[model samples]
Target: MSWLDQVFPGTSSKRTMIDRSQALPGRTTPVAVPASHVVLGHPLRGEDPESSAGIGRFPGYQAVVLAGGCFWGVEEIFWQVPGVYTTAVGYAGGYTPNPSYEEVCTARTGHTESTLVVFDPGVVDLEGILRVFWESHDPTQEMRQGNDVGTQYRSAVFTVTDADADLVRQSARRFAQVVADAGLGPITTEIAPLAEAGGERSDGKCRDGRFYYAEDYHQQYLAKNPNGYRCHASTGLKYPA
Candidate 1:
């Protein structure tokens, strides 16, 4: 057995193995909100001079979570986009709390390597954000992006509000048409409504899925490690005029 099995004790070898089965069709999961909603009331990262400086500068910022694949490249792509206030990499659409990078990579957690993008809506519209997202990765690759194969790499947009959800659906439909016109296969990105922040389900139980901030060193990984592997693909395809 490996060191992980030794440390965790009850973990089975088969349980640790990654599952590649595509998520079931129309399998709708409730989107739980992060435990701490208000940044000032309960900050995920306590008052650090740098983070405070960053947040203070952007008063009208909004948050959106997107899961593409291998968040290293996804986060890098959004960090460079104009009007983005901040970008943090985390695990979402999963059933584990505070999951480690290793656990998420194994695919058992049901989490998708995702990025939380804080941007100024006044500067960049939702459509622009979706445009960049759709263009940056292949949405049709079920549960996989390039060599990264697992549920954690599945394409998804986790919207926090009804308006955001509607926009996502509309934009996806338009993008789907564009892809179809270009002779590409159908877009398979998942769109779902977000649950209330820190609320338990109808069973009066808290689900295991929670956003765990990745290791400090993993933050802005591509910017830190310039020669990192990037699996992103762009068709150079534009939306129909």
Candidate 2:
């Protein structure tokens, strides 16, 4: 039996399996959300236009998540970006709901240390955001980045839209070509749709499926601890140069 079959059994055949080294073996703790809420990737079972109508409402602002090594540095990089409105460090692409920092660290919660970046599309396009993401860390590492070993530190780009997903795929291909020209190894960054908590819709008013804020001190660790560890390394990517 395949890994998914071992874990999800009957559900495995129907669901698509992402190459997630960080996801622990077992079922995720189901999160409870209101009936009106719509999860990002899951389709609505019934007609609910209100749940899916906010894709382009905010002409200037958009949200994206990135998991690249330790989130402290990732958070710091996005914080410095010109159009970034907000940057929050948290656990994402995990199985547990509202997982604690310690639990996630143990790799039992199946969570990757991820950063949520809210930015203005007018100032910074999605491609620009992706460029920052690609440059901020090494995507060639498998279930690890620099000295940070384990699934939680693996590289990933969790997209919010089909266009974003396509962009990521194309970018990954182009990035691989660049790396190959530079005599680098294969790219191992995982790309996938942002999984929702209980299938909550993205109607701008929906709450996250399972948002467990990181500890207070972790908000901006790089800012707080100037001498902290950072596993990020530049991959020498320069678009249109």
Highest lDDT against the true fold, candidate: 1
Candidate 1: stretches off by over 4 Å: 1-59, 196-210
**Candidate 1 lDDT tens digits, 1-69:** 755346545444323323223322112332223333222222333223133311222346666778888
Across residues 128-163, which tens digit of lDDT does each residue of candidate 2 receive? 888888877888766666666666777877766667
In terms of TM-score, how similar is model 1 to the real structure? 0.71
Compared to the true structure, candidate 2 yields what TM-score?
Answer: 0.69
- Backbone clashes in model 1: 0
